[model samples]
Structures are given as C-alpha cells and as structure tokens.
Target: MVLLDVEGMKCGGCVRAVERTLQDQPGVQEASVNLVTRSAWLRLDPAALDPQQALEGALEALRSRGFSAQPRQSGVLSANAEPDRAWGWWNQWRQLMVALVLLLLSVLGHLAEAGTLSLPLIGTLPFHAGLATVALFGPGRSILRSGWAAAISGVPSMDTLVSLGVGSAYIASVVALVWPAVGWPCFFNEPVMLLGFVLLGRFLEERARRRTGRALKELAALQPSSARLVMADGSVRDVPVEMLRPGERIELLAGDRIPVDGVIEEGYSAVDLSSLTGEPLPVDAGPGTELSSGCLNLEATLVMEVRRVGRETALARIISLVEQAQARRAPIQGLADRVAGRFCYGVVSLALFTFLFWWLIGSSLWPQVLEVPVVLMDHGHGHGVHQSLGAAAQTPFGLGLQLAIAVLVVACPCALGLATPTVITVSSGLAARQGWLFRGGDVIERSAEIERVVFDKTGTLTLGRPLVEAVLMSDDPSRTIQLAASLEQTSRHPLAHALLQEAQRLNLPLLPVQDSRTVPGAGMEGTLADAPDPLRVGSLEWLRSQGVEWPAHQRDAVEAAQTGGQSLVAVSLGHRPIGLVAIDDRLRPDAVTALQRLRSQGLSLGMLSGDRRQAVERVGQTLGIQTDEMAWQLLPDQKLERLECWRQSQPVAMVGDGINDAPALAAADLGIAVGTGTQIAQDTADLVLMGDRLEALPEALGLARRTMRKIRQNLIWAFGYNLIALPVAAGVLLPGFGILLSPPLAALLMALSSVSVVVNALSLRLP
Candidate 1:
C-alpha cells in the first residue's frame, strides 16, 4: 500500500476523479481517496509493477487532472523537514482577507446608493464593477481555474458551481453596464458578495475539517525524531532515531518519549503509557521490561536495546492502521458516493432548468417579482434608479439569471462526500487511543453488528500462565520432576513453562533425554539416556494410547484433580505409571467484568477450549457461561467448526490469543486478537486489543455502534439539506410567499451544510 498527498481536491467529485485516475493505472488493485485527509491510499500488485514506477505513474496521472501529488514520507518525523505548505492556513487566510476587502467595498457602494452614506467614487457603478472584477480574478482565481479544469476533464466539482454562479453574475452586470439600451439591471455587488461568502465559508469549513483529525495528529506528535545511542565504550551520542538498528542500546532521559520498541537493558523508571494505551497511571519499568515506542519515561534514566524501529514500531503501526481505517470507505457510504459522483452535473442541469422556468413561465405568472425594486444603480452625481427592476422586467432575462445563480451556488456535494469518512476517521483514532486497533471501516461496521462473542479458554479469558499446583509421584518426586523438565525445556507450551518454573524453584537438575518430540493437543515424549524405556509426559488419554497403564488407586486422585479445574499431566516410563502433575491457570483479572459488560449489551457469550471438560466447566461457571455455551476437549479444527456453528445463527466475534485460535479467529465474522498473542493470531484477526485489556472489548464495541449512528445522522442531514435547500434556492417558495434565496445567502448555506457534517463527526471526539 502507498499513501499520496493529493492537492486541489475540493469535494466528492474530486475524490472520484482521483480514485478513477489511479485505478486506471496498471497493477493498481484499488484506490481510496479521502477529502478530509486530502490523501489517497493505493493497493498495488507487487508482481505486476515496480514500486517506484507505480508512484511516478500515479503522480503523473494526478498532475494531468490539475492536481499536485507527492509520496508521503513513512520515516520517523523529522524536525528539520519543512511542514506541508500546499494548503497552509496562512494561504487560506490571505485569500479570505482579499475577498473580505472586496465585499466591504461593494457593500459601501450599495450604502452610498441608498443615500445612507456618501463616498467619493465608491457609489459609482464602474467602481463597483472593478471591485467585483478584482475579487473574481484575485481571491476567486483558484476557484475559477480549478472549476474550468474539472469541467475540461469531464468531472466538475463544487468549485464548478461556485465559479459559474459568480462568473454569470459578473458577466450579466458587465453586459448591463455596456449596453443600457437592453433595459437590463447592473448589480456588480452580487458577484463580489457571492465570492466573499464562498471564501469565508470554506475557511471556516477547513478549520473544522482539520479538527476532525486531531487524534491522528496527536499520535504522530508522540514519535520522537531523535534518540541517544550508547556506543560500545559506554558513551552516549545523540543521533536520528532512524539511524538506530536492532541490538543497539539507546539511553532515555527522564520525561523523554521512548524512541523505539525494545526491552529495558539497564536502570529503572516509571513510564507514562497514557499516550499510547489511554491508561491513567504510569507503569513501572525495570530491567527486562518490554517498552513500546511513543511512551514517556517519567522518572529516572534507562537504557533500552532497540528491538524494532521506523515503521515496525508499535506507534508507527497504530498510526498506519488509523490512516488505513480512515481511508477505507464504509459499506453504507456506497449510496452517498454514487449520489455525489454525479451531483454537480445534476445541479448544473437543475440551474439551467431553473433559469428556463423563471424566464419562460414563472416571470409571466408573477410579473410583480420584477417590480419589487431590487435593482440598485448610480448615475454620475450619486443619483440611483429605483425604477430599474420595473424596467428590467421587460427583459426578464436578468431576473431569471439571478435566480439561476442561486440554484448553482446553493447545491453542495461536499457534505455527502465527507459524511461517512470523517466519522470513520474520528472513531478509528478514538479507538486507537483506547488500545483497540480497528483494521478498517468494514471491521467497525461488522463489529457493531456482533450478536455473540466466543472466547478461547486459555490466554484469552485466563491469564494463560499456569503454575505447578501439585505433584504426585510413585517414586521420588524430585527425580520425576527432573526427568519431565528435561523433555519440556525444549517446548514453549504454557505447561512447559510451569514445569520449568517449578524445577527452578526446587533447584532440581534435569536429566538429559534423546529424540524428544511433541504431539499437538496431546503431549511430549523422549527416551532417557540412562534408561532402556522411553519417558512420557502428557494428557492421560495420550499415555493410555501409548499403552501406559494408570494405577487403580491413582484414578480417584486424578478424577478429583480434573473435577477441581486442575489439568493433570500423566507421567510414565515405558508402560510404567510414574506420577501426575496438576497445573492450574487463573482467570484474567478483567475477564468477569468484561464478559458481564458484553452480555449486558445483548450479546450471547461462549467459550471454546481444548482443555478437559471438567476444567472448562469450572471456568464457565465462574464466568456465568451456561453449559451449552461452553465446549471443551476440542482440537484447533474443532474450535473452528464450533465457531462456524455459532456464526450460522448470528454474527459472532471470536476472541483468542494463541496459535491454535488463529483458524477460528480468521473464520469468525469479526476476529479480535489479544495484543499479547502470537504474531500469527494478531495477523489473522480483524481487531487487536493492543493493551491486552479484556475490559476494552465492550468499549470498542460501544464506540463502533456510536460511530455508525453518527454516520447515519450525517447522511440524513446531508441528503435532507440538499433536498430542501435546492428547491428553495430555485425559487420554489417565490410564487407562494415571495421568498427567494439570493446567491450570497445560498453560498453561506452550502458551506454550512458541509461544516455541519464535519462538526457532527468531530463530536465523536467528545466524551
């Protein structure tokens, strides 16, 4: 995927044009353009095109469409680099100031004509005409140029409507001034007012739009551009963060943001992770504590070995995911896009129809409209004509033209285009700050619809770190543990760690074993070098399958252990029962509260695990899960099958944190992976709880539902505003109540429509 900063996109039409241009390029699988971010994300086929070539081609294509495009830098933020000035706030402010000056001059000319004030040459028609001309060619130049370019390229946007509205008013005024014999009215102030309102509205709209992306900007700001590198001789040198590589040590000072994801090698401190995980309190860090980039070291200095840098850092990944999520269009947005794609063309046609209707039939039906004395003019000595409206009624063309300009300027396509993406962007960023990384808008939508949440037994609901609770041995307990530890030391299974910890606690030395192998969902086996028979340590079923007989007296003890939620591992030496090791895993501190929250949200909960039924049952009862909702003694494939069955009834979200849960996670409607899970599980899941806090599950779902609701509200407002405002602007209420929307007033309303949508989306940032 590649991100490109695109300039000169003014509305939904521009988004469609850019997307179409990029999609037409070879090897480009998909292209998504965001008006709010002013960026395009392209998914390319690596096999079909080189990365450099594809970028150049895309840039060239955008340039041909009269847009500026550049590849976005993916490196750590560089303080020395200049900020983006393509659409700088200062530039917008300058344009708005120019329009304001022109508008004030035109308004003064009208005041002079009304005998309310007297000025030297301000009241003159020629002066007002020149002011309007300056406004059009100065502050409004970009609008005209971009509109013309879009029209030439067969993709007109909101700019096209504004340009046409302002240009038509200016031309009609010029014709009236040049030829008074035509009986037309000269109103130069109309054009100046229209341009001024558009410029002012856009300035305000841009400010609100920028605020919607505050979360992403805050996250980006947390990345430190430089780090203190510790040389081999124990001296520290300041260097760029990008220059640091794996295995290199970096020294972090107090109150400094961590520059890389790594483990603490020396010293200790209380680091502030609130910026990354939204945790209120700082967490203590010591030697061997894993630290992620973008966290703040609150006290004391520490040295950390760089494990991941650049885009590989946790902060970078979160930023990238947020960007992708914002760029991804929601499924519900398809209807809006389809409507906005051709909205300008339809608006232009409606403007033409409005002109023809008012000119041919409406003016004849209500001739009094022309006699309302709206036209203002200035003769040589500050003398004004209040009779121009009546005189211009004979022509009727000027009256129709004025109404048509209102129709053109009042229709807005930007609101519809921005409604969905702005909300998605805000919601994604909000979720990220809370430690939930939603992959895309589609994921957010699906997550909101979840009816059931099925969680894996170990590692997901429980802490997953089991401890050696008891040890029963037929011979010597120390000898049995030593033999088992030798074979288990080579495995990374949770049970292996438990046994190793116990061996270390007892200070027991392990015996060497040969040809050790592990069976999935079963156990481990190896041959002792000193013994002729093979040694085994696994589930009771696995031992019995290997012809190892369990003593009648031990059956009662093992049953009691299993029934008590303790997992028993049978030990044997060549068909001879050695002993039993009972391991027990505790539930996660937040599991009970998280599950209860989910259930309260009208979602059914279930648990699936490969552990013994008795053990799974004990956990299910503690969590309030019914017997029918719990499944145990299952393999990886069985978990997938069970998840599928649950999904058949309703959309199910599967949460897991082990390699064994990857299949089920991928198969579910929505896959939520624990942040501490295996890389494969995280990769296959749709949403990842980056903080590994189960309590965030309910919050994530609630945020998704709220985002979707915001989207619906925005869509309704966008569509409703256009539906009602268009007819009013076209003079639908003129014949009934003599109410006609002027060009400037229409322009203001159009701007407000878009601003309202964006502001509504920004509300998601609020509490």
Candidate 2:
C-alpha cells in the first residue's frame, strides 16, 4: 500500500476522478481518495508491484485529471519544513484577505450612494464598478477561470456556478452603468461579497481538514532524519537515517527516537511505546530486546543493530494502514457522490428556469417584482443625482436576473460531497486514540451492522490463566495428592501446574511410580507399589466410563465445582474417587460491565468455548449470558459453524485471541482481536484492541455507530439543505411573499452549508 499527499482537489468530483484514474492502473487492487484531507491511499498486489513505478504511474494519472500528487515520504512533509504545505495554507489566507479588502471597498461605494455622500476623485458608479471589476478579474480570477474552463469542458464544478452568479451580477451592473435606457439596477457589491464569503469558507474548511489529518501527519513527523551510525572501528558518525541499511549498528542515545526497527545489542533503556500501544509507561529494553521504529529511548545509550528501515518499519506500517483505512468510503458515501456528480448541471438548469419564470411570468403578476429583489440591497435611487438609469429595480429583467444569480450561488454540492469522507477520517483517528484500530471503512460499516458478538472463553472474557478454586476428596487425600503429583509432575498443562504447585505449597513429597504409562485422554496410570491398587487420575467422565464407582462423600463437592464453571481433574485409587481438583480462569474486572453495555445497545452476546457444558454454564451464568447464547465444548470447526449459523440470521462479530479462532474470525462478519493474542489471530482480525482492554471493544462499536450516525446526518443536511435552499434561491417565496434571496446572501449561505457539515462531523469527537 502507498499513501500520497494530493493537491488541487476542490470537491467530491475531484476525489472520484482521482480514484478512477489510480484504480485503472495495473497491480492496483483499490484506490481510496479523501477530499477533505486532499490525500490518496492505494492498495496494490505486492507480487506485481514496483513501488516506484506504481507511484509514478498514479501521479501521472492524477495529473491528467487536473490534480497534483506525490507519494508521502518521511522528513519531506514536516509541518514546519514542508514549503508546499505552508505555502498552500498561506495562499488561501492571502486570497481571502485580499477579497475582504475588495468587499470593504464595494460596501463603501454602496454606503456612499445610500447616504448621498461623495469622496475623492471617484464617484459612486465608477468606484463601485471598479471594485466589482477587480474582484472578478483579480482576487477571484482562479475561481472564475476554473469555473469557466470546467463549464467549457462539460464538467462544471461548484466554482462554475459561483462564477456564473458573480459574472451575471457584474454584467447586469455594467449594463445599468453603460446602457441606462435598459432600466437596470447597479448592484456592484454582489460580486465582491460572493468572492469574500467563498474564500473565507474555503479557508476554514482547509483548517478543519488539517486538524483532522493531524494524527497521520504526527505519525510521519515521528520519523527521525539522523542516526549515529556506529562503525566497526568503534567510532560513531552522524548520518541520514535513510542512508543506514539493515545489519548496520547504530548508537541510540537517551531522548533520541529509534530510527528503525532493530534489536538492542548492548546497554539498557526504557523505550516509550505510547505512539504504538497508546500506553504512557516506558518498557525496559536490554540486550536482545526487539525495538520498533517510532519509540523513544528514555534512558541509557544503547547500541543496536538495525533490522528494518523506511516503510518496512512498524511505524510506517501503522501510518499506511491508518491512511488506507481512512481513505476508503462507506457504502452510504456513494449516494452523496452520485448526487454531486450531476449537481452542477442540475443547479444551472434550475437557475435558468428561475430567470424565465420571474421575467416572463411572475413580474407581471406581482408589483414587488418591479422593485429590487433583496431588501438588504440598496438601489442608490434616493440619491437625486444618478437617476439616469431610471427607477432602480423597476424592470422585470433586473429582478429576474437577481433570482437567477441567487439560484446559481446558493445550490452547492460541496456539502454533499463532504458528508461521509470527513467523518470517516476523523472517526478513524478517534478510534486510534481509544486503542482500537480498524483496517478500513468496510469494517466500521460491518461493525455497525453487528447484531451478535461471540466471545472466546479462555482469554477473551476472562483472565486467560487459571487459578485453583477448590479441592474436593472422599478422604484425607494426602496420599491422593502424592499420587496425582507423581503422575502429573512431568506434564506442563495448566491443571498439571496447578496440582504440582498445590503439592509444593503443602510441602508434600512425591512418591515415584514404576511402569508409569500415559493415557491419551484419561490421566496417567501406574503401579503405586505402596497403594493397594493401580492409581489413576483423569476426567470424571473417563473414570466413570471405566467402571469406577462415583464416590458418595465427594458427589456434593463435585456438583458444587461443576456448577461454579471450574475445570475438574478427578483422581482414582483402583476406581474409587481419591481426590478432585477444581481450577478455572478468573473473570476480567470490566467484562461484566462491558457485556451489560453491549446488551443495552441491542447487541446479542454469546460465549463460544471448548469447555464442557457444566464449566461453560458456570461462566455464562456469572457473566449474565443466557442459555441460548452459550455454546460449549465446540471444536475450532464447530466454532466456525456457529459463526456461519449466527451470520445467516444477522451479522455476527467473533472475538478471539488464538490461532484456533482464526478460522472463525475469518468466517464471521467482523473479527476483533486482542493485541496480546497470537500473530495469526491479530492478522485475521478487522479491528485490533491495541491496549488489550475489553472495555475498548464497546468503545470501538460505539464509535462506529456514531460515525454512521454522523454520516447519515451530514447526508441528510447536504441533501435537504440543497433541496430547500435551491427552490428558495430560485425565488419560490417571491411569488406569494416578497421574500427574495440576493446573490451575495446566497453565496454566504452556500459557503456556510458546507462548513456546517464539516463542523457537524467534527462534533463526533465529543463524547
């Protein structure tokens, strides 16, 4: 996968175009583009990919589509050092500042006419007209040229409609100034005001985008530029980190960031892993301890041999994964993009109809149409001097032109285009902070659809390792303990450890047995020599099936242990129950609360375990799990089958941290892994709990659900805002009521509409 910092993407149309271009290239598995961040993340088949070739090919493709792009490389895009990034932001501010000055000049001209005041050598008409002309051809040149060129190319954008709105207002004002016989109003402030508002909104949106992408940017910033390369002669030289190859030894100093993934060769230090694990505590590192890139050496200088540099490092992989995940679109986002694709043409056509309706029809019926359309606008008619243009706003053509301009300026597809991508990017970052990492937007969508979550028994819901809970026997059992310890001392199972530890705690000595032989499923058997019969230790079922009578005295204790969901290892002397040991894993402190919270949110929860029915029931009862939701003694294949069955009814999420769970994880609709799990399980999971906390699971689900909600809200606002604002901009209210939206006001509202969607998405960060 490769991540590229893209530039010149103005809207969602630009995102779609860039994606289409990149995905069409060879070896490209998928291409996801984010309009908000102006970034593109690409997935490729490594077997067929040459990174340099693929990146160059993509850059050329984007260039053909009118976008500038470059693959993100470490040390090149530091916020303080990247000239292009700095200049990009500075350019936006400069344009907006200039537009504000031009707007002020235009406003003053209107004020001069309204108050019948004169200033300097320039009169009202020339002064206002000059501001409008400069605003169009000067500060607004980029917008006007892009809009005009897009329209000519038959791929009009939001800028195109804006250009038309400002241009029409300028042309109308010029006619009123030059050909006064046409009886038109000279509203020169409209164009200047439109430019000012659009630029301001764009600047703020860019700032929001920068904040949203701060995490990925921070990740890139973690890459160090220099490393102290330790030579074979025991001398150190400062060299560019990238210049150091694998197998080279480097000297790491206290307070210096590890330049690459490597093993510590000598000395000791505390490595801070906050960037990767989200934990603030530093881990102790010594000889042979593996250190990943992006960690800081907190103490003592250590000599280390580099293993992986550049993109192969863990830090680089994390950044790439996050960027790719954020770039991919959710299913709902496609709807907004489709609407935006045709939005420009639709608005243009609608504006034309608005003009024809008011001029040819409505102006004749309503006397208000004979007056200026907007009340905020002043016609300068009260000034007795420049009455040469006739009664201002008395003509139907002039009033109709204002309505048309309003429609053009007010209809914005930018909001619809931004509805999904912004939220997804922000949500991805937010999830990372909470110690959960999603592989892609598809996982987030799948998470939101989850109706049932299956939890693995041993390590998932409970503390993985077990502790002895109780010991039951039909007799004093000292001999039983001695016999059981002799049979199980050599074994390394959890139960065997428990038995050996118990005997040691009691200071009991083991008696050696001769002719010892191991049973496959049953416990080991041997001639006790001292005992009256051959001793046996295994599961109660195995003993019972072998004709060993159940001990009456220990039956109640056995029932109690079974009901408590503990593992039982029974010992027999000549088929008579000698002793029983109860062992079970402890429940996590947060497991109950987490499960309760999940249930409250309408998710069905279940326990998937390989434990027997009695043991599984005990844990299930304590965790508040219902009988139907518990599946016990299931093999790995059976667990996969359970997932399939559950998924058939509704989307199922399987949580496990074992290699055995990998198959079930792959089969489920969603798989969540504890980071402490085996590499196979974590690799199979769609999302990882990096901190290995159970509570973070619910946090992830909640974040996904909230992200979906934000997407829906933004989509609704984008669609509804356009639907409502478009007709109003077309003077729908002008016929019955005297309400008319001026082009300048329309532009301001349109600019705000997109900003509002972005702000709303940002609000998801709260709570």
Clashing pairs in 1: none
Please list the residue runs of candidate 1 whose C-alpha ends up more than 4 Å from where it truly belongs after superposition: 75-82, 372-395, 468-559, 568-582, 676-682
Lowest lDDT 10-residue stretch of candidate 2: 382-391
Summarize candidate 2's per-residue lDDT along 363-449 as a digit string, tens digits: 787766564434432233434323312133566776677778888888888898898988888888777655567877778888998
Candidate with maximal lDDT: 1
Clashing pairs in 2: none
Report the CA-based lDDT of candidate 2 relative to the real structure.
Answer: 0.77
TM-score of each model, paired residue for residue: 0.86, 0.83
Per-residue lDDT of 104 in model 2: 74
| Alpha carbon lDDT at 722, candidate 2 | 87
Per-residue lDDT tens digits for candidate 1, residues 1-767, read: 87777889988888878888999998788888888888888888888999778878889989998888887764233233335543477888999999999888877787787778888887788888899889989999989998988899888999999989888878877887888877667767777877888888888888888787778878888887799999999999999988999999999999899988999999989998877776667888999999988999999999999999888888877787777777777788878877888899999999899889888988899877765533322112213431221123345676778778888989999999999888998898788778777878889999999999999988889887898877875567777777778889899998899999999999998888899999889989999888889889999889999998767877787667656778788788899988888888878888999999998999999999998887899899999999999899999888888888988889999998836687898899999887543244237888888665789899999999999999999999999999998998777876666566666777888888988998999999878
